[model samples]
Target: MGFAGAMVVAMAVDALLGWPSKLFARIGHPVTWLGGLIAAIDAGWNRESDPPALRRAAGIAGALLVIALAVALGWLLQSLLPPSWIGIVLAGILAWPLVALRSLYDHVAAVANPLLGGDITAARAAVSRIVGRDPAALDEAGIARAAIESLAENASDGIVAPVFWGALFGLPGIFGYKAINTLDSMIGHRNERHEAFGWAAARIDDVANFVPARLTGFLFVLLARKRSEALSCMTRDARRHRSPNAGWPEAAMAGALGVRLSGPRIYHGSITDEPWLNGGARDPLAADIGEGLTVYRRAMLLLAGLLAILACA
Candidate 1:
């Protein structure tokens, strides 16, 4: 068994078992641990009084340090483990937490379930856990759109990208990608606190996500009922999104579900007049969220099948 074999097992394990709550309570999460490290770096070096250039340099150093640490750990695991069934199983277990298919589905379902029950308040609260925007301000359609958008974007960031790297560079590759992603999440904001300090992490994350985002879009196109619309969204509207990589999957999802997304969202107290993807499409409903989950499930299955074929080949 090799990288592809290990990834297939890991993905299956994640989809079936996810992370156990008992285990999580005992040990927390790998991403959470990485976030702690990032926070420590910010506390130590990302000072408000520091010059922008110096802050940026410190951020880069911090990101590099984390990446090196993650890669070193991954390499050590691979080198120490013998090439046998035990090694493959150990590798899969280590990689399982990095892939987030089941978690994503569950979180999105939490929002959809409440909306389906006609509980707007619970729906709003559920959506708040996933998005950065003001959930309190969202109407039913807005909440549905936010959940679908998060599902689409995270399908790339949380699932496809990790598998892509794992297939190409084994455990080290996946761990390194996760480290970069965690750094970006912790410090990669456009606000006063992180704008300069997070520049490197943000750029690195963008580059890391570029190819995987497109792949996610393509997966959406395949799973979408309206294939042409999905393709059009990926080629046309994806470019209009604020983040270079996030737009691809969001556009594909919007087109796939035939719903408008990403226009005039409120963050904190300010309104961001963002461009809409699939602007002419219908407003999303709770039913559309269910539909999006169906498409997401199909896409994950397709990805798994593709990886299985690759592993055999």
Candidate 2:
């Protein structure tokens, strides 16, 4: 199918049913099973006393197997159903599990409302629900900063990347992407335990997200009426991130909002003094977090419109 056709199908499904809870749970519920498989594979490889290259190869092979399983499941389900409205229904079902637009807004609102109401304690508690940071010590401004940063980062990871993959290759693409993302969230890390074992998952996620991240940055620029500088922000800040992909959308969001992001912050009691992006912009506020939500929604709209237009063409 053409890109436009795929997008049209994807968007129509998104609008009509949002996400099919049953389908997502049915298709995605097997990570537990897959995780066990990977654990066994890793343990077997560990006992071999192999070279680092061999161990890395085993990890990559395991990751590939997990991806293959998801794709196969999606394909198998797609084949069994009648082809009448199956494409749209299946696409919707797949997309439902993949996107989290409503959930994202609700999560941010949980923090925004409480903070605006002058209940710092309530606000901290709410922010902690979505962010991994320590909420106990955060003041009003700190809470706002954390919420805004989380929203921007999630714009790329949670929203754009999945949508892009779904558009590119339909359910299989989205499923594959989500599997990689899930693996990354679960095990991909730089900490001592995951540094070596989770290397494959992290690296694959980095590669898979590379183009989507850049595309998402462009989408943000277009939505913000600053298309000219969007690419520049993407180019400049793309390298600033250790992950190689997250910086693209973060920088674009920072530039669009005219607020700095990516500076030093404490994670799990340790401080990461990462260089900041958009340092020249305004200090982030709770209001900016609200504005970030607006930008996120607009970007989603632009994507939907693009999909519709592609279908039209």
Candidate-wise lDDT, in order: 0.92, 0.72
lDDT winner among the candidates? 1
TM-score of each: 0.98, 0.84
- On residues 153-197, what C-alpha lDDT tens digit does candidate 1 reach at each position? 999999999999988888898999999999999999888999999
lDDT of 2 at 57: 73
Model 2, 1-313: lDDT tens digits are: 3433444555455556554568657765444555666667666654346666666676677778778987777666655555455565555554564566665777887888888778999999999988777788788777887787777667777767877777777667777787788777765777755566678989989988888888788888877645655556666776786668878888887777777777777788988788777766667777777777787889878877877676566
Q: Which pairs in model 2 have colliding backbones?
A: 19-96
Best by TM-score: 1
Cα error, residue 170 of model 1, in Å, equals: 0.8
